[model samples]
Target: MQSKIDPDMVDLNERHELLYTSSPIAALPIEILSLVFHEVQRTRRATGKPMIPHVEITLSHVCSHWRAVALSLPSMWCVFQHSYAPWYGPVRPTRERLAVYLERSGDHPFDLWIDFKTNEPAYQRLFFPLLEITLPHVHRFRVLHLLSNANHPLKEFVEQLASASAPLLETCAICPDYSHTSLTSLIANKADIFRSGVPSLKYLRMDETSMFGFLPPLDSVVHLRIETRRTVPSWIPNTAFDAILSLPNLETLSLSIELFELQAFPSRGSVPKEPIRANKLKHFRSAYVLINIYTLSHVVAPSLESITMNGVDLAGLDDRPSIPNHVAFPSLRIVAFIRAKGGSHGARHGPNLQKLMAGTQNVEELLFWGKTGIEENTEKTHCMLLGTDSAPSPWKKIKKATLNIPFSSPTEILLYHQFIAAKPNLEVLRVPPRCLELPTFLQGVPPHIDLRAIDESEPPLPLCWVPGPDWLDTEEDPFLFYCRVFE
Candidate 1:
């Protein structure tokens, strides 16, 4: 039985074939294809998943027209992917693919992220060729969680990268090399190169390396993150701190110090003698489980506008010293304190906090957590929490706040009252679950606060009572304590 094709459907099929066969590439506008490619690249980067499959690349490799269109746009070829790990060893096409992408990328600095945890030995071989391919063109580079044991090759590779002048490389993040290689020689060799000046470079982060020594004077760096852990103290020289402070562009600094296992910057050595003040810094976050008085001295900067201390003590105090009124955070706008242990001992509170608040005449937000570090000594803690006896604070400009203390007392309520009194312009107040139990929590607050009602004229003051960790799970279930603020 012969199946007869309908003439109408047959003509439609013939027309489609004609369109597909004759200049299909031209039919797809370059602008439309460019948008498609951009979207694909963004998806790949965001998912942090598998590489763009070989099949996809092969599709573009299928015909001359496809290849021509794909290769014409260099931006389409730039990739910061880990899928090509299979070609870790110095293989033939790996180098070629890298070169093709680099040429296609054409002058736009590229970020290449390589993950070595998948296959160590394979990556060892792959790393060399990749380095050969990337050392010349590195705009910014990051290597995450590389585990290089005794047998792997990392030191040599790092040396090559350090020597390569990446003037445009503004950011680099290399995680702790869990591998057992000593970093002394590595840092010693690269110190001068790093100092010689990469003007465009602004942010640099490294792990397992004590940068207190051998670093050249840093006049260009503004943001620096260095980690040192469980190592011989001899590796880091105090001179590194001095060199870092000499930087002219420093605006924001984040320090995470590991005291138990890692070596501290040399105390007896020559220190960085830059003015004790940070001139342009607007934000600072410190998270050191244990910071000494010397370290605190190194951190105090006159230009600090905001400070966030997570598991850190700002001013290292002695055995129950009076809270000083001289500790400075001048332009402070927002201050957040997060608990590492619980309580505030050998830390800033009471008068010291008042002084900090007074220094920040323009402060708009203030956050405090009762428990962190040691359990607050009852007598001293009461004095600090009670705050000073005064009229509505002229210094309190707090418009937004978050209190996550596990327990609340009369002192905490007093602080809240002070905030409401001081910030006449306060538009939003966020309180933790326990803090809402305070008797006068929303005493004078108005009813019917609506975000929609908030505008240039007829501005609204809205208060948000946030739930504690006990109520908030990964799934955002609304388990909140009842409040009659609106009523």
Candidate 2:
């Protein structure tokens, strides 16, 4: 049987087919479309304004089919970070929007980031329901506690969260909290973490004080990061240090401590009676502490590959601590000591460079920083010269090194010229930043220096960031700004 079709209905069907096949948005995969939405939302947050000019949401209002697809796919509406601006309007509506987003995420594991910049405690209470709904699904959580007031609502949320059983929890990051007077106070207020069994937690980071108290016994955490403040805590307990060492699977440990507060717990028997050792541990970075060489010799696992000390004060060995000779690191490869101009008891490591290299024979990369006041005196500066009568360095295997020189005057340039000329095997040479402007520095240099062949190629010099506490304040790329000239 043949029936006559309406002309308007046939025309509408043809147009819908053309639109679906021709437009780029219709061609996009669901994942790619979700990423596009994420990028749009990210830009809105950075600019600190209310402007959702995307007209896609209005498309679902046209019919039930589009709304059903959008609602069924949880990823389409799971992100809500618009609560930063309080002046925009009431907080209840945003809270409701967040609850909707959480509900849409469903039972699938997901990464959750919550930044509580809003200073109002009353508005924070509104998020409790959202947290209750979303906590179970969080696999990775990053909470930035930027609230200025003493009474932080997020703190209460964390307390409640720690007590609740979260089977899917894996990673957590807690920034510098201004509310707690000390680490003990922070832990005492949040001791409920001890009761919480995060059997699946793998990575944990906290400021030094909270690290002592809140970290429960974890057998699976592979990476641990501890950041301490500039002012030393009154003291840290030995039991706390013991608890840290006891972690069975801790592989990479990064410790960021100020120069004045690098001492090990008790300065005696910090390691537990059980002889706790991390068989898998490899990398260690002490951001600003004058590293206790003895501690390096004893505490590190046998398979250590890289050790970096940045802006630490390495002074007279009289006060330097000792480690048991029984301990040994057989696989050490890269060792870096980055000292800047303002370091206390400056340039002491220069005198012991040979000893350091000899200890790590397999070293591939050795970095040293000598800029301004570090080498102002010729007697003190002579320590860097390889075969000088007073200073000798036998760091033969080093393939790459960096020297930071920050000077605008000619006298410093002439001094640095003399300083760099002394090392014959110096494959990598970093001219001071100020001197790079001069044509003579880069006159005939090739675009890229080839290290393997020593011909006309200049040594493959590269700029590196001197790791210190201040590095945290800037972008995550530690060496990007200093290496812009190379670009």
Candidate 3:
């Protein structure tokens, strides 16, 4: 049986559409209407995450008028997510679809994320053609992320991308060859691939980058991160260290490269006669980077405001920086000691800690996170910060300290009383309250006291306590920490 169209219902639908169009929002200018869609795009993009096409597609499908407006905004169509990863839901667009999106993206810098993990030859049928199509427009790329293995069959393709001049490239993250290729095999290296120059490049992250001799274009990078998970010692030559420190724009530098030697700037056989200054660097975080005393003497970050060191000696008695910590990091305000192993084995671990902290005159905050290296030595660290007659006091400038040690031992639990007793001039101290039996902890602190309340009108207290890591259950779960402000 054929269905019959009802004229009355059709007329009702037409009237409904007409009434919706007459609303105040529908009368908005095309430019203003575009912003509604643009905002949907910008809200997520501003977070530095990959933009999904669903929003743009949904908005365009709302109506014919909306479709035209969505199509008009080039940036709304700038992202090409080509992936086979389970996390990204596999975005395998045909060559025709990619070409259309590229043309519609206008001259705006585009972002391309390609993750091809599978090694099957038949699965990569479309990847090669799409890659070829994007090559001609590499200069227009703003961010290019290529995720693949060390011996990915498309290495030559990536090598071609390395040679291409990406004048507008701002961030590029890709796995380097990772072939365990050594410096002696320099001929097999692709470190100098961006030889054509990526002038606008600001952030560059890669793996196994120690084999690189030098790249003139690296001076433009502002944030450089090199992380390798392998146990092989990364050969960071003095020439390389000197070159990296010389980067005038380097701001946030992180290196997890292996440091096997103790020499200051160890190369084939050379060391910097004087300290190399990373004047523009503000934040430096390392894992096993400052293992040796001579390593600290080679580079000084004058503008460093924060430092995070892993596997470092909490007691820097024997391996004190050739230059005192304060001298090397004058602007440092934040310091975090993560997983620090002890240096010299002796009594006065507290004094040794005080000595280790002598140079942090300007430090305002300290975080002792992870109990791996410092769990057994917490009392010593706490005693040093508490400041006994023998050990010098913590810097007067320190306003906050966090003890994130997940300690359960009866001996370590006693340190809570130590923190409560010490008048270290800290306004706020965050401790894991679970360490203290909740009832006993509650009895210790006054109920419903605001730490921020004490000010000029009210006399200030020398110290205050707040439960940290935000795990507590009370009547009002949000602000239910029984806090205290007292010396």
Candidate 4:
């Protein structure tokens, strides 16, 4: 081999050896490597990954140099996920694990998800000690998520949180018990958890609707979401309505309320007799939450860009003030109607849809998801989506149409097809795979437009009218596809 080696080959071998001797990441500065590690953890959290041993622990095991860097950076250990489930055999929250994170994190702020849920009843006794250890560091919490359900224990922890002050808490998500009979809200004594005031609080998400009473002064909140799954009467008090409209910095507001006691409530809330302009509010979402239009009418968001109304009931179509001049969205761009199941109640979601379309002239995207069934009430609903021959198209500005609705009847498909034909500016169409079964379906679609068959919940591939949807799904590794598409 030595005798056969050419001078050029020797030079090539030496270069290859030099390249293989050093790691690509080893050349990167410590700061850049830290950023990369942080990005990996962030992506995992964003994707709902609550893995074992923490991602920092895995990074520390890569090599001695990496271990040194990971241990040196307190931020690398600040996010502690002490979540436990029954599936992980023999893997539970241990004192040593908690101690390691607390000691390594040092004075750095914490992003904690304390989901110590276990099937065993005795686990309650084991978790309180852990919470007590964590309670002292409450002031350093930047983000906190506490998950507990109806059958699990919470009185002990809720009592502890009632007096705890989180000065640095900016985002908090509380998933309380889902059952109607159980304790629905975390605030039992109506005490604000953050006694020192959450001036830094910008985002709060609550699963139960009854948590409104214990909510602290939300003047500084930017994003507020209350997704109540209970079918009981969960009315938003006049005070709560006023609090929402008065938020000067509120950018997004999502509410999911039941329809049980909506009809009995008054049409308007007092005090805000005049329209309060929500200047900073850009997105408004309501799911089956029939707030008195007369009350919410006072909230005029001229800067609103997106609207998502699901199973909404705007009183009745014949009712007064369907589209009040005071409630107009000139800057609106996107509209989505979800779970529009048909019936008398299903039709009510349309009047607001009509009002929104009539009120705006710049709607650029429209999504109709989970739209099913047919009934007497759907007549107006069909008209609202299909448009009339006599009337001009108001959604001519719509560039993308996401059709997650099924066409069981030919008339329904025709209506949707007509809706598509009317929009000359429609450049992208996202339909379900079943739509391809019909040969004539989208046959008229111009080759210039990107037509994708994807699930309603998933986003369409961003290819320039070429690489099919299958290409996006070809790579077995999600990271490779993500990099190929996004990078």
**Candidate 3 C-alpha error for residue 405, in Å:** 1.2
Q: 377-429, model 3: which lDDT tens digit per residue? A: 65666566545455546566666766555445544544544544443556665
Instruction: Give the count of colliding residue pairs in each prediction.
Output: 14, 0, 1, 0
Best by lDDT: 4
Off by over 4 Å in 2: 1-67, 77-91, 117-132, 136-153, 176-178, 181-196, 229-234, 258-276, 290-294, 311-327, 339-354, 369-382, 385-392, 407-487
TM-score of each: 0.65, 0.67, 0.74, 0.75
Q: What is the C-alpha lDDT profile of model 4 across 74-100, one tens digit per residue?
A: 988887665555443333446557667
Candidate 4: C-alpha lDDT = 0.60
Model 3: how far is 275 from its true place, Å?
Answer: 1.1
State the number of backbone clashes in model 4.
0
Clashing pairs in 3: 326-359
Which RMSD values do the candidates have, in order? Answer: 9.1, 7.6, 8.8, 8.9
Candidate 3 TM-score to native: 0.74
Better-scoring candidate (TM-score), 1 or 3: 3
TM-score for candidate 2:
0.67
Model 1 agreement with the true structure over 1-487: per-residue lDDT tens digits? 9676454775664655445456555577867866776676565544434554532364365455556667777666655444334544334555676676677767665755444444445556765666566766654432112223334435555655444455665655444234343343332224533443465767555444424222332456676655443343333444444344435678765554432222223433343354345566665655543332333344456676666554223333443223234455555677655444334433544444454445456767655544435455432432343233543343446666554443355554655555454456666655554444445655634442211211223211111213222111111111111111111
